[model samples]
Target chain A: MIELQHVTKVYPSSPRPALDDVSMQIDKGEFVFLIGSSGSGKSTFLRLLLKEDSPTKGVIKVNDKTLNTMSKWQVPKLRRTMGCVFQDFRLLTNKTVAENVAFALEVINKPQRTIKRVVPEVLEMVGLDGKENRLPGELSGGEQQRVAIARAFVNRPLVLLADEPTGNLDPETSQDIMLLLERINRTGTTVVMATHDYHIVDSMRRRVIELNDGILSRDQSRGVYGLGR
Target chain B: MRVNFVLSEVAAGLRRNLTMTVAMILTTGISLGLMGTGLLIANMIGDMREIYYDKIQVSIYLADGITDPQRDAIAAQLDSSPEVKDYLYESKADAYARFTQQFQEQPALIANTPQDALPESFRVELVNPQRYPVIAEQFPNGQNGVDEVRDEGDFLDRLFSLLNGARNATIAVAVVQALAALLLISNTIQLAAFNRRNETNIMRLVGASRWYTQLPFILEAALAGLIGALLAIGGLVLTKILFVDKTLAGPIKAGIIPPVDWSAIAAISPVIAAAGVGLAAVAAYVTLRLYVRL
Candidate 1:
């Protein structure tokens, strides 16, 4: 479902490349953990996958389409097929939980009937059915993360790229988010999550790709974090 | 993408930046008002030119005790001149009667004037009003029966030039104010975008197109512009009713200045509205393109 061949990304005014000649592949329906410390090119990897920024060299193919050759107008269409969740949860603070989930569908121009039917079902799946009208500020951190996950999954995207989904949560709350993500993965949504949380990484034995100094150092099946880095 | 969603977002954004929105509306209103005033002045100048240019005349006053033969000779010269299109010889009694009629509203001034105090003159319309110097050269002042040759067109020229200068000054000030209004609109749009950056970022991630995220800010600017245009039109209407119609009634009634009718205001109303909305929307779009990421 995803392939990167010798991708190199060098930002202007920076001494070194953000990602240097990195190549990797992930099959469909795989829950992969991208383990790296800060400035280790984890976020850069996800950004390239989303086509938010083009690689300086080499090629990236997501779902059989070469991202490097895609036109600018097609970028939004490509992103519509994949959902993204950030470390900050990125919820519209003024909106209620249900409105936040519906926002994703609305952005894609979904019909009102579809948005009405899908929003509630996704909220139910994420365990936020009853708190539809509660704003993000009124919700707990765990609940807010659940809203973000609901928003990501509302459209039933092919792949979910999460950048430190539980970075701001407590340890117990982080486990709940991990379990929710794992549940989403089991339902045939490929998940690529970047994180520095070792406990959640070790608890879930999945395909792990580790980055060190802009290079792919390890790729292991049924892997744990901090074992090869 | 959805119209309702875009509209709701616009409403929310306007509410969030209510003060800035109001400021933008008032600024746009003042700018558009000045522009409308400039346009009205230009139209009035055109009308006044049409009315006055055709009526411009040069009056050649006679000496106090000029003989009939000298008056006849002057008349013969005026009739033979190619520059004179037409001429009216006003006797002293005729001049005094015209003076009384002109100052009828000021009875006291008319009463103070003697019956024969006004001079007998030849009111000559030139083939081209600009050929006044030619007539003055033909009949020199203090020669023949000509006491002094007065070109009314010259005074009208100076008056119209002063009016034109005032019109140009008004338009220049209006241009500067419009520029300030555009800058304020750009700043307001930037602030609105910054305040909602988090929402915009999420929209971008959730597959909203850049245009979809930008629609709300653009719509907010357009809405303010629309309101400002309506206010400016209202201001113009009020000025016409309270100031022009009421305060300047005497001059308009006496035909000193042309009346600004409803049709004239109607002619420029759509232009003002279009300018207000179009300028504000363009400014907002440019600001977003140049400064805001989304």
Candidate 2:
């Protein structure tokens, strides 16, 4: 489902490369957790996965297409296969929860019939049925994050790339979101989650890929977060 | 589905920026109004031109001291000229009789004038008003047995040109004002778009087509222009009734500018409306192309 061949990234005006010679892969339906410290290049990796930015050196193959070779115009088509959740939720404040999710479909020029049917179903999945009409500001932190998640998954993409889904949530709420991610994973969709929350990482015992200073330190199936400790 | 969703989003956007929408309306109103006034003035002057131009008469006054052959030669010249429409030669006797008819109440005063002492002149009408100069050019310094040739059109020509120039200047000033309004409208729309940069960026990320994002903004700009034009038209009508015909024309009755003609006002209203709406939409679209394109 995803492959990065020694991908290296250096943002303009930066002294050092963000992702230094990183190469990795995860099969279809695999749930992968990228655990790292504050500046482990986790977000950069996810950005490359979604084709928001390209690798300075090396190739990124997502959904069987070489991202480097694709023209600027083709980037959106590639992004259609993946859902993205930011740490801030990045939901349009002016739009209601339903409209926010519906926007994902709308941008793709989805028909009214599809919008009517799909929006409600996704809102239900995010446990935001009655709250659909409410704006993002009216929602709680967890609920807003849930709406963001719903917007990502509404399109039924092949991969869900979440930078930090549970970053702002309390422990109890974070676990519920993890459970939701797990539920989504069971539906035969690839899930790549990057998080600094070691407690959930250690407790879930999912496949883990560790990166330290832009280099992959370890890769384990049934991996543990506090492996060194 | 795509259209409905975009439209709903645009509606939501417009509602979100209610104050902005009203501002646009005001801006459009000002610009369109100026344009309308300029057009009305130009059209009114045009109508005055048509009316006065049709009745323009050319006077071929006879020489003060002339013989019968000279008079007959002048009559023959009038018949030969292509510009001549219909000529009436009022002889001294005929002139005397007509003068007496004009002041018939003063019978004793009319009795003192002799018929042969009266001035005989040929009242010449032209085929077209434009040909007055053509005939005048032919009879320079009374060359064709005519002692003095006066068309009465030279004064009218100078007056028409002066009025036309003034009206044209008003239109030019109005165009400049309209341009400024268009710029303001463009700036306002740009500000509206700038305020919603995050919304637009998100739409881009979500694969929104260029049209889906731009349609609402373009429409909003056009709406502003339309509002401005309507206000201008209304103000113009009020000004025409209250000021143009009522006050200004009354004060200027002794001068060159005439009373306001309703038909001229009616002629160019659509042009004003179209200019308003078109300018507004164009302003929005031009700004969007520069600022909104991803």
Candidate 3:
């Protein structure tokens, strides 16, 4: 579960707050879609959730842990419970698919035996079982995204935050990636994805949260992309 | 935390940036070598000072026509002088014998010297060599039985000043070279971090701690520094065997200059190694903090 109470983030160079006194909550095991145009504060919202940038004023709680009061050393621990995927698959080009996926557990000081056993199982879950040795450059866009997803899910984080994960993929590949995310969400991990793709948003009909100029415009359950545009 | 994983990362990093790593190692080696040389020179200077200063004496040469009564009067005065710690009266024959013994290796030089050419003198050792001027004033040159009074301390002072200058210059050059080495290490670390930005970014996304991401870079720099230190120790060992022992054997054997002992090199080896490792690791850590986010 994630909770934001009147969170407002203002960059010093900017004239307005990126997130203006917004409050929201999402329970566990929910698939949420965050839709907005460019510079709609969508990325800012995700960044605040990751604690990459602090909210200028307000509190954020992830799984009942207050992020504002979290010590600097605890940020990494907080991040460990939440998986993150970016628009750019962000895979290590030199590492094989299995290595990239195992990297997550490795950084957390996972045992070698666990890494060895779990990397293949997660790779198989993401449909990357046969391509374990292939480099990211050798994979297609959808497959690379799958690799990224597998890496994020390898540790079975409590929540998954994705930002424009399918920004570079074609519509067909985007649907496949959406299906993969849907599958991941069904495993009781809360999923929050931010995107500008109207087609995918309309097709899925998940809970839609729209942001308009840093304001929370809508929070609709089983909502279409352009329902109240 | 995993030793093999971190080590493999370090090796991969070093191999990935082989040229930079070599540059860092060579620069670190040259600087540390110079520093070790400076330390050795300082040690030698200290030993030489002890040897030369301990033997510092004021010699008062007697006149060629001096009678026994005048010499006896001078000896009586020297024996009662509070400034003199000890004095040895060397006759003309005694002086000639000492000269012959010193020049025994060069038979031609000893054969050319006449017996009476050497002067009878009192070799006066003072409590403090710096008080040579007091003895010189007491035993004036060209007075009574004294032909000339000279202080060996003056020549030793000049020699030590020259040696000190050389030591200071070597240390100065070593410091500058160390600075250059530090800058090269900073640049190399920055380049390494930049090259691996993508991997590090993903690592961060997966909750890798900042130190975890930065460890490989720090270890790479440290490993290079350690190797550089080993090279510097080797250079010092080589210098001692090839140059000091081989080239300066005559002076060292004659006790004109002190020998470069193996123990001296051994003593300063750890210091040089620590400097290499500490400076490179610090430089890499600082570079990461200032320039690279990951």
Q: For candidate 3, what is the DockQ?
A: 0.73
In candidate 2, which residue ranges exceed 4 Å CA deviation?
Answer: A1-27, A34-79, A92-100, A106-116, A127-139, A202-229, B1-20, B41-71, B81-161, B194-202, B243-267
Instruction: Give the per-residue lDDT of model 2 (tens digit) for A25-99.
Output: 899999999989978899889878867788999998988899999886677778778888777899999789998
Q: How big is the positional error of residue A34 in model 1, measured in Å on the Cα after superposition?
A: 1.3
What digit string (tens of lDDT, one per residue) describes model 3 on residues A17-107?
A: 8888889999999999998788889999998888888999989999899999988778888889899887899888888999989888988
Which model scores highest in TM-score? 3
Please give each candidate's TM-score.
Answer: 0.92, 0.74, 0.93
How do the residues B94-192 of candidate 3 rate in per-residue lDDT, one tens digit apiece? 999877765666789888999999999988889877788888888788888799998877778899899989999999999999999999999999988
Q: How far does residue B46 in candidate 2 sit from its true spot (Å)?
A: 4.5
Per-residue CA lDDT of model 2 for B116-203, tens digit only, reads 7666778787988667777777666555456666766777779778877877777677777777677777777777787677777666
Q: How many backbone collisions does model 2 have? A: 4
Which ranges in model 3 have alpha carbons more than 4 Å from their true place? B91-118
- For model 1, state the Cα shift of residue B157 in Å: 2.3
